[model samples]
Target: MEEFTQQAGPFTDAQQWWIEKIADATAATETDFAPKLLEGFPFSARGGTFGFLHDFGREAAINLLDELRRALA
Candidate 1:
């Protein structure tokens, strides 16, 4: 998580907010963290094509962060 906050740069304001929120929720061990995260980005295929693409990009960012975390660990 620290790795994410540190190295995952060049993020938009909204993306940065989400990243910080995720880190905070994770550190606090928020039980509903996943749900809250999803709620924050309520974009889906059913919503619109662009939204789906945006969500896909967000997922990729998350996957990259996870990979980084695992590699560091």
Candidate 2:
């Protein structure tokens, strides 16, 4: 996702922390947290869902991810 890549370097460091918070919070409120959110994603949007990520709307990020997947495929 363009927005995701721009917001977080990788889901490696601070970005990982950012998304972990959302996962943590979601888990506290819902039992089906990670699975529900991660079911069909490209595995790169996690960082953005947390505070570690910034500025990416869903469409831009999905589009970017789709393009990247297409290229890789």
Candidate 3:
């Protein structure tokens, strides 16, 4: 995740904000749950992927937050 943030740039304001939020949430999560929750999160913009929260857009990000909430529950 740090690699993606350091290497990727020029993201939309929304994308940037959500990515940081996601990173923060991930950091707050328990170590065991973090990996599973982020298992499919895109870490790079390779192979036509949008990378991280860029691919998630607003709705997906919201859904992911909900999932994270559920996991923490």
Candidate 4:
């Protein structure tokens, strides 16, 4: 399972884009979501097929979406 669980962040990257769109549409800028996204990491290290940061970003995106859903609900 771990072998198949390659680190991936493109999904997270795209997710953040949508979130930004929503924020723009609503004129909202929540610091919570405003983490130096690509901070502390190189561009090449972000959307790889395997890495701890990638996995972390994926999980973070999931949680962020969930929060958005609940808030909107």
Candidate 5:
């Protein structure tokens, strides 16, 4: 995941900091679920796929929060 992030660029500063939030969300959501999904796949694929989803979902959710914060501000 870190390797992919390095190649992609852009999320290397403040945005990169938000990754903790994403990781937390992923851990909470997948703790029980990913095992089911990964049952037949290669063991190494787990981290990559989990990270991909975390980065995607966290960015999306934060984008949504922009409006809420604006309205509440």
Candidate 6:
């Protein structure tokens, strides 16, 4: 994920600090039935695949935060 961090460019600034939020979300959401999904989020890919994986996590973070943000807002 660190590798992706470096390449996330414009998004890097937006998401760089979101890592903790993402992680917390992952932990909370995965604490029950979805635990496996968050535990072994494999990142073993290359090139385009890596990019997708990178974006996957970021998008996932955003997706998970959607409801949280809305509720808070």
Candidate 1 global TM-score? 0.46
Summarize candidate 1's per-residue lDDT along 1-73 as a digit string, tens digits: 6555566566666556555554564556644344324434332313333432364486765574465445344
Candidate with better TM-score, 1 vs 2: 1
Which candidate do you rate higher for TM-score, 1 or 6? 1
Over 1-73, each residue of candidate 6 has an lDDT whose tens digit, in order, gives 3444444444554344444344455556653223223333331222233333455475665453453344322
Worst 10 residues of 4 by lDDT: 1-10
lDDT winner between 1 and 4, please give it.
1
- Best-performing candidate as measured by lDDT: 3
In order of appearance, the predictions have TM-scores of 0.46, 0.31, 0.38, 0.30, 0.32, 0.26
Name the lDDT value of residue 13 in candidate 2: 62
- Please list the C-alpha lDDT of all candidates, in the order they appear: 0.49, 0.42, 0.50, 0.41, 0.41, 0.41
Looking at model 6, the pairs that clash are none
- Model 3 segments more than 4 A misplaced: 1-3, 32-73
Displacement of the residue 52 alpha carbon in candidate 5, Å: 17
What tens-digit string does per-residue lDDT give for candidate 2 at 1-73?
A: 3354455445456544534443454545554333234433433444334322243346644553444344323
In the order shown, the candidates' Cα RMSDs to the true structure are 5.9, 10.2, 11.4, 12.4, 12.7, 11.7
lDDT of 5 by residue, 1-73 (tens): 3553454445734436444343444455653223233223332243544444464466653452343233323
> Best-fitting candidate, measured by TM-score?
1
Candidate 1 minimal-lDDT segment of 10 residues: 43-52
Choose 2 or 6, whichever is better by TM-score. 2
